[model samples]
Target: MIMAYLEAKGAKNVRIVPLDADNEKLVKGDFPSLGKTVEVAIAAHGSSTGFKSLMNGKADIWASSRSVKEKEVLAAKGFSDLEDPESEHVLGIDGLAIVVNPRNNVTQLSKEQLGLIYSGQVSNWSELGGPDMTISLFARDENSGTWDSFKNMVLGKQFQLSGSAQRFESSENLVRNVLQNEGGIGFIGMAFVGKSKLLAISDGPAQAFKPSQLTVATEDYALSRRLFFYTHGQPSNEYVTEFMRFAQGINGQSIVRNEGFISQNVESMDASLADDMPADYVEMVKGAKRLSVNFRFQEGSAQLDNKALKDIQRLAFYMREQMPNSKLLLIGFGDKRKNEHRSKLLSKLRAMAVKRELSRLGIYPQKTTGYGDFNPVASFEGASKIKNRRVEVWLR
Candidate 1:
């Protein structure tokens, strides 16, 4: 659809070509009405290649499934500051969805369970409440962005996948493999979920959340990530800038949704909670001042991600300098999953995790408590459950 729109807007002789070394598959389309053709190179060599390709002048635009890293930006400094605001564009958002055979009765999984499964810590389906059978694991090859996201978001930064895991270069192939194996589980972009049943994921013990427009757009889904486009510096070419503008514009975002990825235009935050929410839960925010930092756990793990770790450092500094005498209250919230008692306990743990981290930095909260599944700042079902799975430090 983007290609069709571009062709309609007069981009001629547009051909997507791949380097001979690229092993990923290719997807191509043609718009005869506007005399344009767009070929998509699908080699799963990871997003790092996109930045390298852009810097070398081999590609006009790098369609990346992940954000640009600091090192990649440094590598591209010779030609253009690809990291510059004018050069970077967010095309869409996607959630790395966990998929299982439709016949599998398991409806949800904790991120820890997934990490264990992929890392071969738990090998049998019965371990996760399924029938007695070996759990077949399928995954994208290391070259793919999906693999990168899954490794970092689901598996911890240092954890390596099990040697026995099957690796596929194409998401379509990976999904097909999963379809044929009832005991198989794999991760893929929401775009490729198709007939495969998507497992609702939980960060801790909270209710499982599925990948949906609401979740992915708002980054409530644990594996939700941004999709990007990188150009050499500010895209000096007229056509390049126009195409980017269109990609970020309404029509492009519509196409993004149509392609099964979440649109960037979706609201980032939710302002209201469910009507049936407890009055006290809703009132918790009435008087206490909210913190600028929102501390959430890494998907399924107690450890914080790099970003959250940095945020924690900054927050500790803020508390020491800005509110030295003010009593800090840490409120933890959880997604609606399991029973209220369990959810509340999970929420409390999340808050405690934040408090513990702050304590190491010499900042301690006056009190910390968890509110089970109440007062969501984002959708609780399929989107941004992370918004609820958070610890908010308030000034009391």
Candidate 2:
């Protein structure tokens, strides 16, 4: 969608050659800015196919809804580390919304309950305090990145999607089916929530949150995920590199928001502090607003992940433009640890890490602290627990 928008904006006499009845394989035109004919070939098969193409030298950019897998990184050893911040580009954010028929009264669910429902352990709506009707499941096909995210984030290793569930290749089709069945429940990207009802989802002890631009952008929403464009090392093709720059720039991010995905544009919103929030944490945030960007680390390590590296620059730019004189605060949180002091130290270190990065970009924060394990967004039991290790930005 972003590519098509860019082509329309900058290209003249654009031509699209169909790969099939539904997908276009080649888009070519004379782009005025580049002063040359540019042709881009896209294969919209699936995320896995993109990685496969990348490994074989058939694709310069692997556009994906999910992060590249470790196996894929190993298979593409010929290229630079696929997991490096240079090669892994986070293009946008998306929230995987759990949807149900609008008529259904259930408005929220915990992640464990969701796993149970999808795995057929709790097969009736009444089990969840809804109507007595038997639940019907709908899901994306296994090949879909959406399915992969849902499986990893929601189902984890303990549960498998029930065999009775109906699967569809298209989110719209799945949504349409869900809309027709009052007992139906399914998950789709936030953009596809459409007429179907969306459920506020909670992970671990975090309060249930509805998918919104703010929540998803902050990654406080339980199901939020990043959309990516992976290149082999730093892209050598000037056109490919240029296109990526455009995609991550203001005009491209605007297109992202318009297309119903969350752009990485930094914005501030009133903090929705939970009642269970620690007294000191609440006191610190008083009269302050939280930025939409969250700086998260690579699992168990204080090093900023690929997305956080990009966010450091975004946050710095935002500070200059929107809140140059505002009082800035950085608070970090970490997963539970056996040693409380170690947890606090590690969390503080994470915040300091973010502060150092911002300082280099000429944005100095006023105060930095760590809440340790006071608030967790996911259970410590699974890989998703990495969400707990993060630094949040706030402005007064």
- Every model's TM-score: 0.65, 0.94
User: Model 2 segments beyond 4 Å from truth?
Assistant: 1-9, 13-18, 30-37
Clashes of each: 7, 0
lDDT of 2: 0.87
lDDT of 2 by residue, 252-340 (tens): 88888988999998889886777788888888899999888889988756788988888888888888987888978999998889999
Whose TM-score is greatest here?
2
CA lDDT, candidate 2, residue 369 = 96
Candidate 1 on 123-217: residue-level lDDT in tens?
A: 99899998888999999987688887787677765356999999997899999999999999999999998899999887753445788766565
Q: Candidate 1: list runs displaced more than 4 Å.
A: 10-45, 80-82, 267-396
Evaluate all candidate structures by whole-model CA lDDT and list the values in order: 0.73, 0.87
